[model samples]
Target: MSTVVQDRSSAGPLLAKTAIVTGAARRLGSHIALALARHGANVVIHYHRSASQAAQLARQMTQLGVRAWTIQADLADAAQVEALAARSIEASGGVDILINNASFWPEDTIWDMTAQTLQTCMDVHVMAPVILARALARQQREGHIINILDTRVTDYDHKHISYHLAKRTLHTITRILALELAPRVAINAVAPGLILPPDGYGTEYLARLASTNPMNRYGQPEDVVEAVLFLLRSRFITGQVIYVDGGFHMRHQLYV
Candidate 1:
């Protein structure tokens, strides 16, 4: 099982602000939402088919003494993406933070990857965040945008070619948006690696991969979450990517 971060903090680092965290129904996304709410930020939890989970997580965050609501949208649909951004802005009165943490990871080699799968990857991982960021800029919302990228964005995993391709494109988009939405809104990315093991896997599964990174160990979700908090704390830190990967991203390998 992955390590968990309970919502017990009493600090109010994000008091009176609102955040919209994509894919906040479960797993690491739920942890991030809880952390933001613990810091006094009202959170809008976004999910697609996980309606019950999203609602329950929203209620849990509200128990942290912060406003929390759930929104549903198919991130793979352009129109739904637009509506998500618009509705969130209307409901939150202006979003102070946007965390593009939703993911659609599937294993497909470059040779067997389909155009349709690739397009879905682009829509969910790349364009959805772009649309939300553009909406924020159009609304003149002054806040931070943190894109959740993978440490494998450099094409290390030849198995998940489409996923890596889309994430790599998002890596580039983060920099471009930072330049385009300067001063008023800052943009950055957090690339995480080996933070959680796959389903049905346990600690030994993670420990076996310790040698894959320079630190010789995996990290937890809170490790990635802290890097996010650091970025949010600064107004001058835009267009930067913090790798919370136990230095696994520094390992050099091509299409492994």
Candidate 2:
């Protein structure tokens, strides 16, 4: 099993600010939401098929002494994405932060990859973030948008061609949006590495990959959360991709 690290620190209240976390039901998304709520931000936990998990997360946040709610939306659907932004605005008065953590990663060799698979990855990873950011920017309210990117963007992986391509496109979006949303809303990315194995990956495989990092250990979700908090609180930083990857990218090909 993958190692787990938890932070039990007490955080001051965000004083009723609102944040929307896409795919907040499980894994990294859940961790991010809890971190923001612990600091006093009311979170809107969005999930598509993880309804029960989303509800449970909301309850957990409420127990932390702040408002929390769940919204179900398939982000790949442009309409649903727009509705999500609208609903969040209606409930929270205005969204102060948007975390685009939801993504789809499917493994297929280039020859076996279908157009549908490629399109799906692009839609969720690229199009959704762009659309969501645009909608939020139009609100004319000051806000922050964080895109969750993969560490592989800095070091390409040939196996997951479709997924990598989509993520690369997202990186481009981050740069363009940071310039476009400038002076009002900050746009940045957190590229995590081996924090949690991709869903369905086994423990042995994860352990092997962890050993490849220069730190010789996999990163915890809290590591990424720390980077996120830094970006969110830093009033001066924008258009940067912070890698919370345990120095995994610093080393060249291990076997070459």
Clashes of each: 0, 1
TM-score, cand. 2 vs. native? 0.91
List TM-scores for all candidates, in order.
0.92, 0.91
lDDT of 1 at 5: 23
**Candidate 1 lDDT tens digits, 1-256:** 3122233354444776889999999888988888888777889999998899999988777666678889999999999999998889888888989999999988899799999999999999999999999988887768899999998875367988889999999999999999999989999999998988876789899899988888888999999889988898886889999998877776875214
Runs of candidate 1 with Cα error greater than 4 angstroms are 1-13, 253-256
Error of 2 at 103 (Å): 1.0
Question: Residue 126, candidate 1: how far off, in angstroms?
Answer: 0.4
Q: Cα RMSD (Å) between model 1 and the true structure?
A: 3.7
Range of the 10 consecutive residues with the lowest summed lDDT in candidate 1: 1-10
